[model samples]
Target: MSTRVLVQQLQSLPDGPVTVSGWVETVRDQKKVQFVILRDETGAVQLVNPATRPPAEPVDPSTGSRTAEPQDAAADPAERAKRDEALALTDTISTLTTGTFLTVTGQLKHDERVKLGGVEIKVASLDVAAAALPETPIAADSAMDKRMDWRFLDLRQRRNNLIFRVQTTLEHAMRTWWIERDYIEIHSPKLMSSASESNAELFALEYFGEQTAYLAQSPQFFKQMAQSAGFGKIFEIGDVYRADPSFTSRHATEFTSVDAEISWIDSHEDVARMQEELLSFAIGAVAAKHGAEIEELFGVAVSAPTVPFPRIPLAEARDIVAARGYDIPRTDGDLDPEGERQISAHVKETYGHEFVFITDYPHEIRAFYHMRDDETGLTKSYDLLYNGVEITTGAQREHRVDILMEQAKQKGLDPEHLQFYFDFFRYGVPPHGGFGMGLARVLMLMLGESSIREVTYLFRGPTRLAP
Candidate 1:
């Protein structure tokens, strides 16, 4: 009876009898020797078993004639037991499937000929925990939708496993950074009596007695409420819903929004600086922990972006794109997908940086609560783009109740309908500002993944809702 160990730990242990447990990755059933590639959470290893065939006829030395040797039931008990166990293991290893969960008692032997980690396990016994089906529904080359259909099986790939590991480290680092700065962590309600932002993207449902409640599009309103409650700085990493019927690779019906609000920011510049610092910190933490592995697995080097990410006003960015022979197709003066890519290319070429802040968006394209500069009538808002994809939107909020009401009216939003959000301003709130960032979008761009579905644990879109 030996203690179970992970496949990764076997390399460091001295050669002796040991037990390892994991899902079977590959089984090579050869005539003379058998090998199995077993994989666990940490890594994979090779397991070897020499063939133990049944008793056969003995050859005579004189004339090379066969001497009859019938299988005997009454053979020596001890030797028979050993032979039976060996045969059973050989047979069991031959029958094991690719995803079978098993615990193997073996002798860990360091062999130079072994390719996987330069170690091999001579299996003595195997206890099958579960057996997977013979036919696999997906493969490494499976389509994203089909692979997501069987995500539990798909995640068995080492790279997929690493994605989530990196996600965990990134989030923990961000949380630690916030917590150390005395920022309050809050969980705003997902169900709201009114819309959090635009009503067009709201997921409305009947609550009780014909009362309709909507899923929060973002924590924008309540996070601002925290600022008014005297929580100077606050952060929330939680789910936010959007009902947009978009088929783009970057769009999702529900997503994890990493939000932060701070009181007393002079303008959106302060908020942008905080976000840039947060990204650099989180990226550096990931690179320190998993840099080598990420490079090996993802083929992308992880680097902590330098501070003072290149900034260009929205008007200048549009001009830069126009100079490059691309017209923004959108009528609202917002950057289209191609425009973002072109401007990002320009930033990378001119500044040698992967991140850029496109600032000073016109009030026409911004939300009602964003503060507009009096002189230019442009909102103090910015969209953070990384590697040619926009991942965040931040702005200084208009805290004056009078101005807020007027802005809501100008945007054709009824003041009475938004009275709850307006109430926060009336109670004398701070000059607060914050941003909402898409976590998957950041990971996708960082990892050089082509689609947000690649980084999201469970993608929610217009068509995808099940596991």
Candidate 2:
């Protein structure tokens, strides 16, 4: 009747009667004793029950002879009741399948011999909450596709559960760090009248008759609008939609974006400094909170990156990769995946850092809103690559409407279509800059995961969308 005791909490508590509820992980039905491993979100624990046989006929206390049996005989009521209850519990536990939900009220005992946490519960009563199907469609070694098909089952693994926990800790830490610094949290609208970034990969939907609306590719426009609105500093952690058809390990059609915009920034270097400090604080929180569990489950030590992540110019990065014998085959003056990897390798070897900010990207590859350097003609932009994967794109924004419009025209983008965005600049807007970071991509790189799909709760791609 009392609140259920969590499996993880049992270790620190004194041994006594307690009730625990969770799904059955494994059942070992034996002739003498039955054992069931019950698992909740916290952890797993062992439950034991001794077998009981049918009771013998009861003797009448007064006559010293066998009592006459009725349809619902209660002869030797106390003994019969105890025996029947044990039989029911033994049978119930034996019938339990993996993933069955149940509650156990029992005497909690700490036994050193028990392999699982050195503790066990002796069941006094068992209540079956829900019975799962006997045969599971997936297994420990199931193929990734099949595992994804049954993600509900796949997530039942403790390691998968730990992934979301670590993610929660990481996000919370970042929010706390930002809030303490007077950053306003904003929830930018996902539905938009126009694209915020490039128009190449917009998800268009028909609004009222003949009117088309598109999912906002990023919070770029509104985030910058926050700067114009004089909010000073703002942060948004929200979902963004993309129609990118690339079937790469790092590509997802929909993903969580971590964005931040600040007013009165000197240049893109200031933005890069804030981002590196943010990552150091956030990743350090993750490592401190879940380091042991991650190492146990993932076999990879969580690295809390130091501040001042190495910065390299995009042009220099390309040359470094080229010098490393890997020429980027792109004409846009951007580093390809292999090139990013080479630069990351060089950074690891030279600076001993896992994160590198590739700065001063060419205007041809960056968004039109990015501020162009007066002398260099390159955009004051940067891409933060984590372990060879690009996790973020950041830049200083051009506040002058005239230059922004001209840049838009130069990029072959219609200035009229972005008039609403330009309006933010037309007003008295301070110099500002921001970044859009992929949350799953960060987790993928931190955990050494091969794909973003592994960290995404429900991956969306060009072809796959369902339960």
Candidate 3:
């Protein structure tokens, strides 16, 4: 009745009996011996078993010649039981398939030659918990869509497991940093009577009666409401839905949004400084905890970014890109994918940093609630870019009730329909700002993954809905 131990714990224990449970990763049923590569949540280990063959034909002692059949009538009872058990164990190992869940009781041994954590287990018995099918649905060389189809099985890969572990560390570190600074955590309602941002990219559905409800695009309005409610600072990690149909690598129908709102900010610069410091601290925690494994699995070195990440205004960033021989094709006063890449490359070359904040976007391309500078007329907002991709957008919001209503009207949104939102500002709220960041996008960039799908646990794209 040995308790189950994780593969990672084996390295620290002295050689003795131990039980390990995990799904079978690989099995090699050799003629003389069997080898199984068992993987648990923590790590993978080697399981060894000596193959027990059937007894040889009975030799006739009188003539010293082999007989046609073996006799069991005179066999020792105890010896017969041991031989039968051994044969059965060997057969079970031979039939074991990949991805089968099982528990093994064995003698844990440390061996310098063993590659997997320099440890091996001599299995005495195996208890099958669940047997997997003989054939696998996906392969190592499978396409991204195919792999995503069987995501549960696909996540069995060691690299995929580490991706989530890194994510956990990153989030915990960020939460710790916020909580230490007296930040409140909030969970905003997902079903809202009105859109959080705009009419576009909203998933609307029928409510209890004739009224309709929409899935929140972000926790923008609620986060602001908290600010009005006298919550000085708050953070939320929750799911937000978008009706965007784009099949881009970064777009998702539903995603976890990491949001933070703080009251009494002078401008977007305050928000930017806070976000940069938050990222630097979180990334440093990840580098400290799982840096080696990340580098080994993802082939990307994880490092904490320095504070005061390079900042370039939207117009200046475009000019920098143009200087590098790339023109932003979009006419919306926002950087296209190519423009972002070019600007990011410039930042990396000039400042030696992977993160850059493209700030002071034209009001035409920004949300109406974003505060407008009296001097420049541009919105005091910024898009945080990491490794050539935009991961977050933050801004100083207009808290004045009159100004807020006017801005809403300018964007073609009816003030009557947004009265509930405006009520927060009418009650005398402080000037506030915050940011909503895509969690998957941050993880994807950190791990050097090409798509957010690799980091998202269950990605919801326009065309993908099932498990």
Candidate 4:
């Protein structure tokens, strides 16, 4: 038996007999012919079976034969082989069900009429394989929650298919950019000895017998430790858990964080430039490789943003939104979700761009470690916005032990509680700053996907805990 060739593998094969296998995406049942749209991760293709009505076998009215009459033995193998292949296909279609898994060996035909990539396979034989229950749990038109309940079915859509491809392309571009710049890529421990920044969002669980352990919320302090330890510039793309339960499209209890920090940077502006370059490479890669597919699937055109994405001072952004008739409905010196939307809309209309950075956030809302600007009483901080969603929060951090301690105290946070994290500053460290961006949210916004779950491989949310 030949190995199971994936649908994607068909593209490289010479036009000849080949075997392909995958779950049936569509079943076009016809009296004189049948077709199955089969899909695997790489691509989708059409499987053609020139078979008479299957199962309740069709009668050959002229000959009154229930079975297909045998092709003449003296006929040429090419024509006879085609006849025999079609007959075998007829029988194979007799037992197929919508979600059945199967392997097929057949002649690959490059035909323009077949809509699936303008290709088709004439079946010689196929294994009926595992058939699914007739009543599908969820249909394409099903509601989001119901479709999520049957996620495997929901992922079959081509739009969902292109999302991850774009993700892979983006990640690759980032990795290449990091490698070329000689930045160390590190994977910090998910289970930590102490909180990286604070206990507010940590997932604490009992440790071996006596003490307790916690899941790291961000690689903040540890990445800083590496800065102290003199790795110079380092980055990590890893998962972090949060205990907060704010149910929003952008909030996830657990999520992949894209983090990076560099020593000897002048300020957060330095960090902001690196971030702009990183995302620029990512969006550019996606535009070059998957832009057309993204348009076909998502109904939106994408472009790799040029360097220096629009930057707006928080105060100026406030004035812009306020002038535009939308007051930020909060007192935190920050924009609310609606305000974010309004500001983003203004950026698009004013600058013709999809991303913007709102910078110099007020010190009060930032973490205790964020470096405070004496001139303005604000932190050297920024949030990168895509379409109107906050995807990253970054700032220059206080490296002075005494000032860091004072800031922690002023925040009503306990010094005794954050002893471990504070120690990074106690030891000698370079002036450094970086950003933590949400992985799925970036992909979600980049592809214009409506929900985080749509782009997440296996979404984890307040209610979703299982496959």
Candidate 5:
């Protein structure tokens, strides 16, 4: 018979036979009917069975999807003992562990009392796909690190569930926006011979034996390389690695980076327009697809930011935030985490918007490639702030090779090592600009999630190395 999903079986007739496959969420057995809440990747459906076994049914070995597997009730003495042990193992999973897998063939019953999905499957036949042990390694009340230990179970929560869905919707919208604009989507290699921005804090690895390679901290250089190669405009959403040991809710060892670059920009203003448009697209798409569910699960309202997100110079924002009595504690001109929060709050209070672009960062604070706005003595850079966290860093690049080399030297980097990168600006490179944002950071803050780990699937963090 063809495979069918449990959710599709909801409208099935009560007497009609149906098949359901999913991890066992819970099993409630009384005197007559036994019930198991089955969950798959999509959602949950309940499967009900009779407490008393019916006539003999053949065990299907194909769908070992359950955490519990049946044993030979009749066998030789030695084999039966092993079988008994297997049955005991399966029986142990009747306790509450949500990650156990099961596949149940059952009848359909639409019951009003059903707490999930408003329908239940009367399990006429069943199979144990896979069984998790009775005890789970992590608790819902566990710390973020602990929950990350059992991230598979940790993601089973409805709030964490909505986070990824919202991410999908937001990314889908961004892709659609880019495609509509005829923007070529690109994937840049994560290994580079030279630092795209700087060399420090790079995760380096051995290349053969003669040379060294570093994992990309961002797709910035390759995207700029595209601009040098005459790709008018481009965007990339991919993983970026950073070796910085930032112990914060927002920091991750590896992150999904959303990046873009374009040629012939009027200034960083052109880049800012695209940023606002793309962000608005993402927010609007998420709100349309899952707004009500987000409100139900995350308890936060999502809205597409209106065009022209409030843009204030970094110095202006610093002064404004300082006036509010929360001085940025950083010695550098860059905003700290607390400063980001306060500035976001300041923007919310002043412009009534959740997003703000703090532009014109001090040259010493921003990367060397950012163009210097001579009038202001600040780089043509901006940090896109969302809901009190910095989600993106963008700027108009220093296309002048001489100035770029000078900037690199001033930052204490060897200019000769960056020969190929500087060579891009030596010839026919356009006046270009772009931005790179962390995808999960945007989603986490958008859904009001406390950490990026909650949104990223199989997150790689400082101490998290395995599934």
Candidate 6:
């Protein structure tokens, strides 16, 4: 009846009686000894038991007597009782299956020779809680889709577990940094009367059996409303929906968006400065806490990004990509995927940085709410790229009601339909800007993973919608 201890705790405790509970990972039943590798959430440990085999005898059918020597009667009562207990324990261990949840009472011994955690446990008794089927559906080399089909089982791998741990540490660090700086956290409603960003990517559903409500593509409108409501700064980590049918490595139907908006910014540069600093703080915290484990598991060294990430205008970035012998194939005036990768390579080679801000996008490719420079006719916006992928979009918003209406009109959006959003500007809001970033994208890049699906807890893509 010893207190149950985690496998991780065995290393710090002195050799003594202890109880450990976890699912069975592996078992090695040898002729003279038995070994069980039990893994709990914290870690795995080795459990040892001396083998006790049953006596081989031919019973006399009528007399209930054995031809072999009757060791049970000849031995002392205490010795017989101990032998019986050992035989039972050995049988129980033999019947144990992989992934069976069990509790074991044992003597914890620290042995230098023990490969796992330099500790071993001499199991005295085991109590099986739940037994698993012998066959497991997934393996280490299973295809990604097959593994995702059994995500619960897939997550049992230690490397997968560390991804979430790193995510938790990253999120907590970001939240702490924001709260310390007096940023208000908000949860904007997901069901909106209209699209939050663009009409093309909205999930409209029937609401109250009367009107239609659209799933928000972003918290853009409400975050802007907060600026008008006099909230100087706000941050939100919440789910956003997109109706995009993209089958790319980074696209998802639903995702967690990490958003931040601050009032009284001079231009998009202010927002970029804040975001870079925020990322630096969060990454530094993660590196300090889990750097060694990340390198061990993911083989990627986690480092805090330097301040003042190199900035290149969108036009200049395209030129840099072209100069590298690649022409952007798209005519949208925005950097295509290849263009982003090329520009990222150039920045890495020239500045030795993994991040760059591509600023001053042409107004054609930006949202209507983004402020445009009167002289340049380009939006005061920037796309933040990390590890050659665009992870965020931030911009100075058009706070003037007149300009907002004209911009909306130019984009073929009815000003009356968006009057509710325009009302925020009518009340005299301060000049503000912010960014929305994909949480999974950031984690994937941090871990050097190829797809965001590797980092997402439950990725919702076009074709995936189940356990």
Q: What are the per-model C-alpha RMSD values against the true structure? A: 2.5, 4.4, 2.2, 3.9, 8.2, 2.5
lDDT of 2 at 68: 69
Model 6 TM-score on a 0 to 1 scale: 0.96
TM-score of 4: 0.91
Best candidate, lDDT:
3
Q: Each prediction's Cα lDDT score?
A: 0.93, 0.91, 0.94, 0.84, 0.81, 0.93
Give lDDT: candidate 2, residue 422: 90
**Model 6 clashes, total count:** 0
Model 5 bad stretches (over 4 Å): 6-15, 53-98
lDDT (tens digit, per residue) of candidate 6 on 117-224: 999999999999999988998888999999999998888888999999889999999999999999999999999998787679889899999999999999999999
Local accuracy of candidate 2 as per-residue lDDT tens digits, 119-176: 9999988888999999999998998778888989989999899989999999999999
Query: Which has the higher TM-score value, candidate number 2 or candidate number 4?
Result: 2
Q: Please state the error at residue 212 of candidate 3 in Å.
A: 0.4
**Model 3: residues with Cα > 4 Å off, grouped in runs:** 57-67, 72-74
Q: lDDT tens string, model 4, 1-467? A: 98777777777777888888888777887877788887777787888876643235558898988877554653888976666666666866765777777888889987777777767898777886788777788888898888888887888777777777888888889988988999999998888866666667778888997888899888888888898898999999889988877788888888889999988988899999999998888788889998888888788788978878899999999999999898677977789998898999999998988889999888788888899998988899999999999999988888999999999899888788788877787779999999999989988888787789778877777788878
The per-residue C-alpha lDDT of model 6 at residue 304 equals: 98
lDDT of 2: 0.91
Candidate 3 collision pairs: none
lDDT of 3 by residue, 1-467 (tens): 88989888999999999999999999999989999999999999999999988867888899999988877643899988888888899999999999999999989999999988999999899999999999999998999999999999999999999989998999999999999999999999999999899989999899988999999999999999999999999999999999999999899999999999999999999999999999999999999999999899889998999989999999899888998998788989799988888999999999999999999999999998999999999999999999999999999999998988999999999888898999998878999999999999999999999999999999899999979
Query: lDDT order of candidates, best first?
Result: 3, 6, 1, 2, 4, 5
User: How far out, in Å, is residue 371 in model 2?
Assistant: 0.4
Which clashing pairs does model 4 show?
A: none
Task: Supply candidate 2's per-residue lDDT for 64.
Answer: 92
lDDT of 1 by residue, 1-467 (tens): 67888877888899999888899999999988999999999999998999887767778999899877776654899989888888898989989999999998888999888888999888888899999898899999999999999989989999989899999999999999999999999999999988887768989998986899999999999999999999999999999999999989999999999999999999999999999999999999999998999999999999999999999999999999999999898998999999999999999999999999999999989999999999999999999999999999999999999999999888888888898888888878889999999999988888889998888889999999999
